[model samples]
Target: MKLNRRTVLSGLAAGSAVLAAPMVMAQGAPRVVVVGGGAGGATAARYIAKDSGGAVNVTLIEPTRQYYTCFFSNLYLGGVRDMDGLGHGYGTLAADYGINVVHDWAVGVDRDAKTVALASGATVPYDRLILSPGIDFKDGAVPGWDVSAQSAMPHAYKGGSQTELLKAQILAMPEGGRFAMVAPPNPYRCPPGPYERVSMVAHTLKEINPTAKILIVDPKANFSKQALFEEGWQKHYGGMIERIGPDFGGENVSVNPSEMTLDIDGVVEQVDVCNVIPAQKAGEIAHAAGITEGDWAPVNAADMSSKMDEAIHVLGDAAAQGDMPKSGFSANSQAKVCANAVLGALTDSRVFPAKFSNTCWSLIAPEDGVKVGASYEATEEKIASTGGFISETGEDEATRAQTYQESVGWYAAITSDMFG
Candidate 1:
């Protein structure tokens, strides 16, 4: 199946409701309130609104006026792309799809009343709610680091100003300075994000300050595309990057932003710049909705609906869906399945079988890229991977360059699919 938004939306509106509770009997058009306007929420809202043809009332609540993609923000650090290219406005979503795009933070979700409480003190009711609020760091995940220390250490995990700030810090580093990264643990957003970031930072330092060093304090023994990244680092940035995994006290780490020092195990090292990507949890709103278990919201594989309440759906990094990595492509893929199932419930449209695919592309150096991907199908237990592919260890320069070009194309296409 194509699984594109249009293709999923093309289901004829003449079938019986797929779900036991259709919500078609609601007094007027069924209302869907979506929280978070990133990949999952935006795509779901757009697909539902565009395909329903004004048959459904859709509202998207997001805090930021301009959404910046986390997927390609690493390139901005590498100086391959600019900050301007990363920003996207919601004007098109509103004017073209007839969506109500509200610029406000969603503070609380009242499942009992089926209402969402916004920071502006307004309450929006919904027959169904989709929460795609992305990842937030766990409190004390890194003992000595918090939001207050971000200005000094700068996580830069989320896009926009944090990313800009981190870039500025990297550029401001003195000659032969050190750049350190505290990589997150398992089940975090963007599996290869920290590694790719290390590559980008290394790329920049190589150009301006070749003597600078990059240190990675990773809790995990292994990471996504480890061999590919290691090979690239050795080839492009030899002897400049070093990684300390759990076996070397990487798991026991802390930071002193004010002192510009990192404490790995009992040893302390002063660093010029520190990028701390702490352990993560679902965004706050998901917890408020009473839908999350531990740190993530669990969802049904077929439709991305919350396990706690059927009326609510969760997506993206916030959702604990099986097999799929927490990535922009994964979120976009899940959104289509959720949209199709939602339309089937609200408009009596045909609901197709749930299928998903995700590919994560990482740029190791200029014009050098590697990727990992899988196709998935919804089984009774979870979304199971059917097959997969990954870039080889020692590919030719031409092949790596081709992979980089392919990633560039994907960025363009996925952004268009999102903002449009």
Candidate 2:
């Protein structure tokens, strides 16, 4: 159950051999190469492979052997769920779903030849390309934050070594040590992620060091589920967590990791642990392929085809999907819509208009959950939301409990949809 890199790769190898014939057929029959095997890419591969029924070839290219979901990652940090629960293997996508899993990074997109070049020196041509490479941090956005400092103060946004590093830092901190979190500006991946992480860290610190503190330095004055978070912090954690918004002069204007200090306006603050989540843009691959216009790729709402290039379809967090928050659920939902459109395009059939849905859950305590959800429908020009819900600002205890149950059910359903 604890799916790690080695185990997952071994599983893929065994499965690949068994499904070799089907894979060959799939490969030979009108190929589609999907880059990035994270939530969106993996989901697209699975659905296309299933629905195409060996008539369409689906090859998924990703460097990693296993994927770690950002959705429930905060639970892992809180010790509510084991890392095994968050870890997923692509063996089923290859074996049961008949998707060809290529364990290589996509180095180049040759639009002229309609092929993708791998770092391993293999060139896989495709009839169409679906890209969902996710988001990449914007360089120079935070002056002193770079790859080297990432080891000492891990962002944990990418969910691999950074996750382990942050976990270690928290575990190794002395009793009553301070943990400072710098949340990004609006429109980042997992809107509730940083807040959820704060709650989870608070959950851990309360047990290990009751007197320890968490300081959140946010750029925005208000955040997702602000009242609910405050209520939970006051009721259970009891002032262990403190928030500093821009209005309250909580901005981390500058950072110097070598000195272990952050300059907030004119004041200098020091902490045992630091988590800096910076501004972001589309992934490097999309930028290299010339699909991104500014921070994100613009795509046609009807089929996720790039507005810049019809042959390339962009999905997930990297796409500039107006009115759609960049969350794992949103990425997965968009992938399904993209898959259906790709199938229709290849076969020259009518593409069905899709309704997309997303729900993000955050755990402020072990069983307490806060959530925001939305349902969207596509128009001729844009993907527009029809309805949405946020956990009521001042809900009763019973309502909060019901939302928590819904959050748990959603986690189960989403993981099933992805890997089952």
Candidate 3:
């Protein structure tokens, strides 16, 4: 059966409505300072403010007023969506949800003082801190590639202008030219993202330059929805996409922007375009706060509270939650769970058990979409998946088309939930 976003996300939306009851505050409201006003932070801030009524003060700290979602970004690359459609402002989160939206980088986290120091030199004290800062590239994760060369070969993983730049580059590629992608390793954000991107790029090239080629230099042995994506690629974009995995020297990679050269072990190929999506770690603030044990900050599986400090909670890609794939839906689900737990601790309200779900839909072409999803329950150790489903390789055309429609619905609903 095809999974509809409305049906899958009904629990999340309804949970917010039910949990959000106006509260009467006795005195000053407890303050929650949220860093990274993306999926997890925005939802957490909105839910806490709405449900707590005037009883809890919520402040959201984000560097940008407009956040472009990483989810569905590949569609924009494929010319299916536009930049304006991808951009969302925090005005509603501030004006409607009563959250103190601050557009500033959280420079330092003084856990001892229970305060967050802003890049603007202001310190905001908080009863609890919510950290949802997303992924940051690991320094030198890929040889011969860094931030300075991103214009030549964009990751476009973060969306916004990066997505635009990549699209422009793809359009400008010479006829019969080659496009290369340096796919990230295991445990990166959005496990199926690289393959979906390859599909999108192939879609665009087929329309403009059918002779062009798309090369995926993947180190991993396999990827999410591997069979489904492989089938779709063969059916829709036959002879356009070539994925070279570790068995074929995909691991040893280096790039030269000056010469437009990509080196895979002993073999060197010159490509017109390159996308270097290197290794990633939790965002900078997570390490700045000293919450991260290694690449990611460890959190309590039940509440997403930082294992280091009970007063701090980490969510989204930055958090090391068990069995949860790092996706927009997962982050939003974790946010709701974190909000309920945080507010319950502060306001002495009822805290319900955390239930989470995530669905990742990727479009191979027009009306040809594939998806994988799971429902999770908070176990004593991790956010363990109870059951899951993925789009079958031989599913009917109608089902694939319906899945695309479901993704469209999800983008609208999830964005509204985050920024509404």
In candidate 2, residue 186 scores what lDDT?
75
Candidate 2 stretches greater than 4 Å from native: 1-28, 394-398
Please give the lDDT score at residue 278 for candidate 3. 91
Candidate 2: RMSD over Cα atoms?
A: 5.5
| C-alpha RMSD of each candidate structure in angstroms | 6.6, 5.5, 7.3
lDDT of 2 by residue, 274-374 (tens): 98888888888898888888888998877788998899998898898777889888888998999899888786645777879998888888878778889
Model 1: worst 10 consecutive residues (lDDT sum): 16-25
Per-residue lDDT of 144 in model 2: 83
TM-score between candidate 2 and the true structure: 0.92
* Backbone clashes in model 3: 0
> How well does model 1 score by local distance difference test?
0.92
Alpha-carbon local distance difference test for all models: 0.92, 0.82, 0.90
> Which residue pairs in model 2 clash with each other?
none
Per-residue lDDT of candidate 1, residues 194-241 (tens digit): 999999999999999999999999999999999999999999999999
What TM-score quantifies how close candidate 3 is to the native fold? Answer: 0.94
lDDT ranking from best candidate downward: 1, 3, 2
Better of 1 and 2 by lDDT: 1
